[model samples]
Target chain A: MIRRQPPALVRRAAGPVLYRLARLAGGPPPGLRRGRDFAPADLPTVVVVVAGADEGSCAEVLDAVSRAQWASDAFTPVFVVDAPVLSPFRRAGYVVELAGPGGLGAAVAEARRSYAADLVVVAGGRGPEAADALTGLLLAQRPPIEGPVGRSRRFLRAAEARLR
Target chain B: MSGAGPEVGRGAPPADDVDVLRVLAPDEDAAVVAEELSLVAETGSRGAVLASSPGLPEEVLALVRRGVTRVLRPGEPVRAGAVVVGTPRPEHDLLAAVESPVVLGRAELPAGAAALLRALDGRLPGGRGNGPEGPDPVGPGPVAAGSSGRRRVLLVSSNGSGLGHLTRLVAMGRRASAGTDVHVLSMSSAVPLAAEGLLPYEYVPSAGDLGISARRWNVLLHRRLGEAVRRFRPDVLVFDGTYPYRAVAELGDRFPGVRLVWSRRPMWKPRMGAVQLGLVPRFDLVLEPGELAADLDRGLTVGRGDALPVRPITLLDQHELVGAAQARTALGLEQDVPTALVTLGAGAWHDVDSQLGAVVAGLRRVTPDAQICLVRPSIARSGADPGHGVRTVSAYPLSRYLRAFDVVVTAAGYNTFHEAVAFGRASGFVGVTAQLDDQPQRARWAQREGVGVDLDPLDPSSVARVAELLVDERARERCTARCAQVWPGNGAAEAMAAVEAVADGASGRELLGRAGASEGRGGREREASR
Candidate 1:
């Protein structure tokens, strides 16, 4: 029989172990924990989303996240690249192009639905208007995983473990 | 054993029968049995036994088993025979009944008794484990000249209130005097002299008497500081505060032969509006402690040293620092806990309350477990109470506490800043006094170098941000490493060499001619040279 440990001890041990495993796997650890009854059906397909007013910044974020090990088999990156440059990411097999020429809020919602994304990673300096819009949307949705992009892989791993 | 009835003392007496006894000395067997009986009475059971006793006192025998039966006669033999007890026997009745019993004969104790006594001595109230005997002497040795016929250098800092300027002067004097005579002139209470062990000149009276408004006491104290210079005439006069500008300028005119040097710490803004306006010019040579050179553009427009003087005058440096673990052990602190040091200059300002509050608040948010130590130069005199979670140490040698810190949080005072940078302790600056704008400016320079963060002492958010940055292990390590990179060692020695060259008149005419010729290039080139 498996002896049960205290919840506090299990939580403490789980975070560090998960972080180590994620590091070994060369990816940011997933921070959220699933319900006891969670199954394959409950697992929302993951996607990395890049939102910014500047197309250059958005492309950079898309390029960085796609290159990460986590984006390999674990999640698909949905680059909501503005109309300017959609070809580079499309050719990379990661793009699920959203149809309207819309602002950040529309881009985030469109990307989230199109890719069935469970987590959102925003990158680049979008000025105050985009920041407010993104913040408002994120707050309303209350996504299980969210953070600034371009942060170190180690920080992402730590953040993921904490959320879990 | 089957035939044995309830045993009575000495003879086969009836259980209900009573008998009075007078136990005498020298009856070993009987005394042992009587002692065992006493033990039974005391413990309320036969848990204890007297292995052997040479004699028994009459008073003790009478009181034994008092509640149960009468005492037995002394000549009566013990029916129980000699009882052998456990090594640690139970309490004896002889000791219980008699308040104070004086036995006449010599008492023989077991061999283990001596060892037991020794063990008890280890736990005794007064013993050898008292804390390290007394305060260790921390002051530096007397300033000595390295070469014979070396010029005597007198460094007088009239920057009363805060000893930051004064401390830098002392460190500079100590270094510069390696080939020259060094004396310090101060109007500060005798404490600085006593702590530094320097020859002090006469004291100037209150700032009010020196024509400085009570509001601007720093300026007034400096006005009267010229008295010290006049008294201790020397080859080189070094002034280390902003207030003593007029006095330093006057001294330069009064004794043209004497070299006047001003060591300016970094400033956030100019101290004197008039000086910023180019109304008054002070000092033949100005020494910028750290990166004051970068901010002031090497004192080009200000008529001061253009480059920062690289002097070997600082106490906190890599070679001087004790290893972090060793320092913690020496200071009796938990080896694992992160330590942070907070310090302010000697001056006691009215706004100290707010500044200290901000620091405490920031510390609470960032690293609550981080050990915080507050070091003030005049800890003994200021009596400034650093609140909870803060340990206040007097003007003990900074060298002792320098290595103990993983990070140092302090106001932008010149001496402490230089020390913090030199020692590679991740430092954070909180601007305290506006009288010396050099502090905030210095903090900015340090921030630019990635050595530390500069936070507005008055702003709660900024303080909290600094605290957050300091607690993060990665940030702290990177900052300290960067600080070590920026500050190469031996600044004090270099500054002193420059001062010595000027004092010997070798660089005087050349420097003056350069100062007069290009005016702009000379000052900037001079600073850059150092």
Candidate 2:
């Protein structure tokens, strides 16, 4: 990626001093690294359909997961996003992969097959739209197996059955 | 992205347009489309035209008929603009050809607008494609500065037991909306503040009041939140509560355009576990508005990791403050009178009668002619009629009528404690025993820092301290001096800047720029207290 334009930092006294101070405080978080360097070994692909609009939301979720010990060992955050969202996530220190033109469903299947994963937890932008996206992914028959979504009791039972 | 308002001058970024590329899944709701159009009109953004879906629902067509800028038929000469949300109107194959930002905030009107308006956010005026405005700015602060449209902020207040959440939000809203359009969707009784013209507000019933299950509350909250977002179309959605409602967090995906900033003030008693941190990731920024007594803070989230700490965000901002003389005049009080303001917050004080009597006694002892003003919830609620000896002041935000008092005696609650000190009044913080509050800690901090007197009404020495603070000019001056030594009263400015940064999609602590002086003040205060 291109070395992006400098960010805008507003201080009462505009100078390099405040900028260096802000820099000294810290970078993103402990777990965040600046690269696409996650191993293929992190299994059970977690499909994050990050919206270009509020790209920060997905980044925040990933940042949280990064803070959690050993969470990166179990889940791989796969991104189904437009161009604007990719750089921020990458810069924040997570290995990122982009979704092709076939849309999210095809992308989920491809990630799962490539990684040989047991489950694919899918989430989309909120409200009924999220439920709709999950339904689309789970109900697709080409995969021959319907996976579970979320931690609801019903989904848990389905996930248990799938695992069994 | 806020620069989308029509007020933006010519050659400014083209943010004033409804640019959602709605891909109708053949069987889409026309009402939703019409709602979107209405929302577009509401924000003064040029409404969108659906490209592919023909045979419009009559309601959607009516929007066009009613001068909605109508849906442009496919292959028609369409006004080209940035697409805000959803896939291209075409099927899978055509999606590759459509080089437009996808529909991220499908349910959220404001979030959708965030994504769409952002197309114009960093770009220079008169062009759409990415130009050399330097490297494309990322994170939340960039767009906060020079922008085209009015930066719309929807401040959501959690309906907690205390008014701390709502009051803090009001302080922030008043300051943030100075150059932005701010609306409050309060889950508490603070809807009345809207009537007073503090800011445009709508009341949504709290989950506790509604008596719904947590899951059900999330559903209702998201529904209400989505509706509010539709109406407000905020670039930034601020959740001012201890914890964000799950539904509100879930809306992140549906309305990816709107950046969610969590303004959580930590003073949690009972030593909360890490359960609440689960939601931390959902926010674009978890802004911890610094507490004046933050050193004494023992709240679980008070100094927990991952949050950007700002200055003490108090309700009594400098710009909106009332001077001592003006406040006395407004309340029809004698300017030279040694008036003691006993502001026992709206919390139910079991010994309220005795509390008021003691406060009055302290004032009388301080000076025989000293006036007594007890600022409580309301005259009806408190039923505090002490004849003419005590005046009942029921300012919605007592901060406005604060200068009416020479000394302020109040509960050590977050808002009142901060307000008294921020207004530069010699204050007495009476520690009220309350669940889930850090009043005791606040009271101790006040006493330690010499910013105010910590009064435990029942304690003789505490009452004596109050009396001394009221009458002793040196004591009052010392307290005022200590307060002046503390952080600058620009918490609202810092908070608004943070919100602006988040809305702008610039990451990192650009808003933390001016915090140098604040940190220095804090360091000195800590050293002085030690």
Candidate 3:
């Protein structure tokens, strides 16, 4: 039970690839798995980690969240950021929190606690196309257990469980 | 629930009402624009979009003043269910091209538009401009000044560990236009403005003081600031703080009609340089109080064109200080003995104990009978006792009694540096390590200018250097001469004039032009000095 966590760079690099794999292997509808045929009155929230130094990449990730096919309120995005976010994101109604010295994981944890979010997502990609490619995967996620469990890990865990 | 389902719109659809409304009408009449904006406000629309066009800057300003939170640009993409308003002309092509439903916008809220708004309103949670907990009934613009014909200015200062922000605001308020009714609204516990003759004070505890989350604190700030805006009906609200809170930025949209000015000082740490720069546009005016070491400034506010740069704002004018003998007598110090004041600020941290000991020990080595006064800043929670003989004095507006000390030992903060140099006091500067302030840079600048000696706290030899500087008559004379030569005139009067002008609706360009003139003169002086 002593699995080592991957380095942040490796996790970041693997994010989009994992998103595609998860989407291609879609399971039951996210709502049905939660035992509700109808949409929940209150949407679950997600702490999206907009980390790293690239502003454009961060914007693309946010764009992906905005374009996510779920209801406009499908999941409220509380951005845990390590980079400078443009004012437009704020105007777009995204709540942004600056990541502290503990880096992206700490920021995600703090954001989740502050916002009472059910899940976390690492919003990183090579470009706008990658962001677009991951939109469906972002919406089709269920709540993971506690701690800074990002989308890549959640997908990999589900895949591992299926193999078992 | 499965996250993937039939396309039933993004997120669960709200009961009714639109999330945002987009209007793309160019060259519309002023009355029509006003009515449309009013309807936007009345419905508490979360955001609005207007067709950007020529002669629309004022319309944009008016819309902002009417309390519309987010106004999208023509090409900026919005989520589904946003109702677009305007005929599909060449100018409106981009906005109309969006997939959302389009409807013709009228001066009056049309039944079709109302229904569309209802549909969008329920689409997003908390889709209200002035929320339920927010102050009700958005009122008219700048009410009359009660027969005085003078405008009212509400000066708000953040809860800084020192009185730097509060002092700057007090300086400006005291010098406001003769009949202008000025009120002080602050979150700082230090409200000694009454001593400076500026009355009508309101105090609100900061998030730290209340031990509340930032979200809750923002809500509290919104409620309190809203209440103040309603009560004071200030023509301009000038916030003196490092970080302009979300509530402060939302003032234009929340209360409407009140002009917002941020009175920020420079000399921030390099790490804190650009994180908050984006919030600059939120203010109608960003008034930067100039620093003495402007040329040597390495902080974030350097070379910024958006802010109007004024000369260093000090709490008291040079002439306001009492003569040395009278100042000494006022502070209960012996008139004949050599005296030095230590104002390193907030003795609770930064190894102030060692710094204080070094300075006191150094001054005592030169003149055993030297009188030393330590200025305990009003905000310090607790401080290390400076042992037996060092006199601990707490004074608000300490600038008024600067002449009490023959030599001054202090931190290189904005207010203290300007006052020490302006008063031509022989001084020694110590740079405290602060997250937001570049104190070492300031201390070095004073040393470079030959106005003061920079003392290094970690260097044990600094003790002897302080003693040498204190006792060296030639060094004292050099400091006095250099201070007199380098001192810039007080900018409080000019800053107040700019604040009042901004209150009367002066554009940032106009004020910046004046700042440019000052900067130009300073540049000329630098060239002349070379």
lDDT per model vs. reference: 0.45, 0.55, 0.60
Give the C-alpha lDDT of model 3.
0.60
Top model number, lDDT? 3
Q: Write the per-residue lDDT of candidate 3 for residues B1-530, one digit (tens) a residue.
A: 11221112123333323344556456444454455545555666555655656345565567776566346566665543344333323333554333332122222232243433343334223312111122223332444333456788999998723477888888888898776888887776455333224566655546544333344456546765765787677888999988899989878876557888999888888758475778898888999887888777777888678888787888788778888788777766677766678776543322436766667766666667666777755433324446545665655566788877778888887778888898888888888887687888888988888888788653546655655665677887788889888877888888888989987779878888877897799899999989
Q: Which digits, one per residue and each the tens of the lDDT, describe model 1 over residues B204-322?
A: 32232122223223322232333233434466777766545454566655456566776655443543444522412445665656453254432222445353344435743466566
On DockQ, the stronger of 1 and 3 is: 3
For this target, which candidate reaches the highest TM-score against the unseen true structure?
3
> Each model's TM-score, in the order given?
0.45, 0.51, 0.55
DockQ of 1: 0.01
Instruction: Write the residue-wise lDDT of candidate 2 on B1-530 in tens digits.
Output: 11111111113342433444443445545566567557656655565555454577787778778896566444432222333333312322222323331222232333454433333222212222211111112212212222457788888888633477887888788777456888887766435542237777665545443332243345445555665675567888888776677767766776777788888777777566467678888888788877888777766775456677877777766557678898888866777877888766443223435765666665665566777776645312434545545676666666887767878888887777887777778888887877566788898898888888777544556766777766678878888888888756657777887787777676535444445456778899989989
Off by over 4 Å in 2: A1-164, B1-149, B160-162, B177-179, B211-216, B346-358, B361-368, B376-385, B508-530
Residue B93, model 3: lDDT of 50
For residue B151, model 3's alpha carbon misses the true position, in angstroms, by 1.0
**What are the DockQ scores of the candidates, in order?**
0.01, 0.02, 0.03
Selected candidate, larger TM-score, 1 vs 3: 3
Shares of reference contacts reproduced by the candidates, in order, are 0.00, 0.00, 0.00
- Docking outcome class, model 2: incorrect
* Native-referenced Cα lDDT, model 1: 0.45
**lDDT at residue B71 of model 2 (Cα atoms):** 60
